[model samples]
Target: MGSNSSKISDLPKNEYLKKLSGPESISENDPFWNQLFSFSFPAPTSSSELKLLEEATISVCKSLVENNPRTGNLAALTKVFLSRTRELRLSAECQNHIFIWQTHNALFIICCLLKVFIRELSEEELQLHFTYEEKSPGSYSSDSEDLLEELLCSLVQLITDTPLLDITYEIAVEAISAMVVFLSCQLFHKEVLRQSISHKYLMQGPCLPYTSKLVKTLLYNFIRQEKPPPPGTHVFPQQSDGGGLLYGLASGVARQVGSSFSW
Candidate 1:
């Protein structure tokens, strides 16, 4: 038995690290999981540092979901990440401009991980997970449903809550484009249409109003060179030659909404 224990201890470092980090070893009370909530990437001066931050973020998200499956642990982690992102956004506003890029990178990475997590579930599982509704007062609420709602709400807040002038134009466009991509996810699309949550959280939330302002801003800038297009004609401008980021994001949002209800 002692020799067997010695053999197990002699396992490769990578293998041991994998075991230690596996979801099975994770718990709601674990310090490692708590640390993930407070984890902040240092200002990345090089591509390598940025890459490390991205990898670490993804690994934490992946392990949480994989180990905990549909448990409250995953939901808690989702909330933590979203809260941290919001804090980072506020920090970026007051700090150096480099933090804006860092926040953008972090948001993009989180969205990518969310997309992967959604795609990993089967259609039936997706439906079951997302379609769940709260029943009795004392009944357990579905963690999957909470996770999905929190993610969508976080994206909405990220785009709509920030002051227009504080966020870079590139970051604004990227956030909008990311929102479009997230809404276009197969499971998310179906849920929004069937449940009408999109109308509640997006179409009527802040996107339409924000997009309208964006259109006006873009048109005003364009009018200096040439006459603006017809009032309604440019509602969702195409990204043709010389068209800008606002146009591209507007087109993406329009396409996403149109496609959601068509099916």
Candidate 2:
């Protein structure tokens, strides 16, 4: 068995991909899927190898998203990938520029997948997405809510923990913009507004830390830049028309702050 496994592992990258991309659908319980889940890329010894590994991972992710037999399994896999990519980004050991670039690329792909998943969700599913078990004793599980919180927390860490010098301005803008779009969702926005007024808090408990980090980063960058954009320039590329996502985000955050200070 060990010899056979070694032989399989030694297969060329193209062969490996061909095998994995074969017509058989991937079930969560399938051995092939499990093997892929457990597979870790060896640390790249060269820039070329790093690029190859990154491309391979992207290919595999696209294939899984397309061919996975279960939505739940795909969601679970996405969560795992997001968590791993976050860990990699945050790791002090992962300081290589190529590695960091690859990590960001992986994050971009994962975010795209997440966007597609959210876009396809029905209104009923969207409602359920925000429902989570209360922290109180004997409360029913709210796995979906838990997952959402985890993702938010991860994004915050990704935004805050990564050094500004290391990350591209475009990626930084997109990350914060994504958060803004998420918070702007009607259901999420109403819930946050209610929480702010009733509980005397601006953002939800899980989102507060990230929100603070985001504000700090934005202010810091704005202050430190040699030349700032014109007064009305949008922070993100897609927000050129109106106040843009950043303005909306700032307003939302300011409201939260105001609620906090209200007597």
Candidate 3:
């Protein structure tokens, strides 16, 4: 228990967030959480280094999630992570290898963070408090719909544009595991998910593969919940009563969108 306590205390504190906004420029010497968002800080230069960083950062975040880190801190983490994902949308002209590497890294980060935070949410947190200032930690959730949409959009483009990127298959599967954990949360409301079927991107001929894959995943998860727990090392949040309703809405929308392209 003491070891877990040590890990929780290392989470990015309010003081560091303030310093991030101050005149002093951030350097690599700063904490990993702060450097993660710094423009000047060096991103991991190799796949192995990124894996190492993911393990370290996620180990800490797992502690924070279990111990209930402050809402403000959790909010800051989500905002910075989401901000980086926008870069993925704009890097279309880059070389294939470069684009693959960038998407791989982004998906890794997203998968790690989701797997950490998508645990069973309390009934109270489902109300969705917009303000994240100091208050009962149970009053909010950082699972933004924007994050979910960005993830789906990026995956759509990748699978449609480069079906042969075999390396991406491993990471994409990892992301699916993390994403399914959200099925029980209130975050899967129809409005936040409607674009999967409605986006012009899906109407294009090339995007058919992703649309089909998306539907299959939803249906798989729907059946998956009723079976024995999946046999994997990945930790899943305990299923809640609300998960059934949320999965119904999610599966329906995904199926509705895929029907036009389903073989």
Candidate 4:
């Protein structure tokens, strides 16, 4: 154990980051996972240190997405990673840790990476990526809601429950950006997202700290996502009714700008 510690400590930071982030295969047994799971801190305080840590997290996640081009393989890996967030208890509550994402930017990094994959991957590639798979004719091991929705709720908690500033502030803005991605891509679970944006926590934010940027992101995406019928033909209404709430969120933020309230 001491030898392993010395080796990890002796390695230059970039080399360590490169090792895991490189084309090299990083199994769960890799020391990288051990290090992430072992490191404990109340919040990420070191800018250079945590920046490299967060970057490493992003690299692994992106590699996972890129490596698993097949839908079946991606879904399998996606379910495992999402489930880890819950199993190890990642949330906005701000407790200290033994889990992989307990550090400051880690959870936010995960949220952002997930947004990238969800937006970039094809719909069919991700349909089963959200939740569970059946083992038999009619039985699933669990009936829990989509893990993606669970993570979305966790983002809502971070946005609403935590005071955004510094790194946390940056995280909040980016989290809203991620939510916009979910909206434009229309890849979210309806009921869970409704739970995320319900009137209960609208006061938490998407205003002030999140005001103009949030509104602009939503509005731009809303317009970009628009699909008018050819020439003068009437279009059918959306069956899934996916993104209406997000549009309302944009209008909601627009109404809150320059309110003269301190965040």
TM per candidate: 0.46, 0.46, 0.36, 0.37
* lDDT-superior candidate, 1 or 4: 1
**What C-alpha lDDT do the candidate models reach, one value each?**
0.44, 0.42, 0.38, 0.38
- Window of ten residues with lowest summed lDDT in model 2: 1-10
lDDT (Cα, tens digit) per residue for candidate 4, span 80-144: 44444443333334432223232333444344345445545554444334432323322233464
| Native-referenced Cα lDDT, model 2 | 0.42
Candidate 3 stretches with Cα past 4 Å from truth are 1-59, 66-93, 96-103, 123-171, 184-263
Could you give candidate 3's per-residue lDDT for residues 136-192 as a string of tens digits?
645444544433344445555443343322233333343443344334333433245
lDDT of 1 by residue, 1-263 (tens): 01112122222222322433353434434554332322222233233433343344455445544444334344444444565556755664785455554445445444434444444554344334333222332234544344554556565565556543334443454456456545555544345355444334545543555545544655663454432233222223333465654454455455434533332
Number of the top lDDT candidate: 1
Model 3 lDDT at residue 258? 33
Cα-based lDDT at residue 146, candidate 1: 46
lDDT of 1 at 224: 41
Clashing pairs in 1: none
How much is the lDDT of residue 223 in candidate 2?
Answer: 58
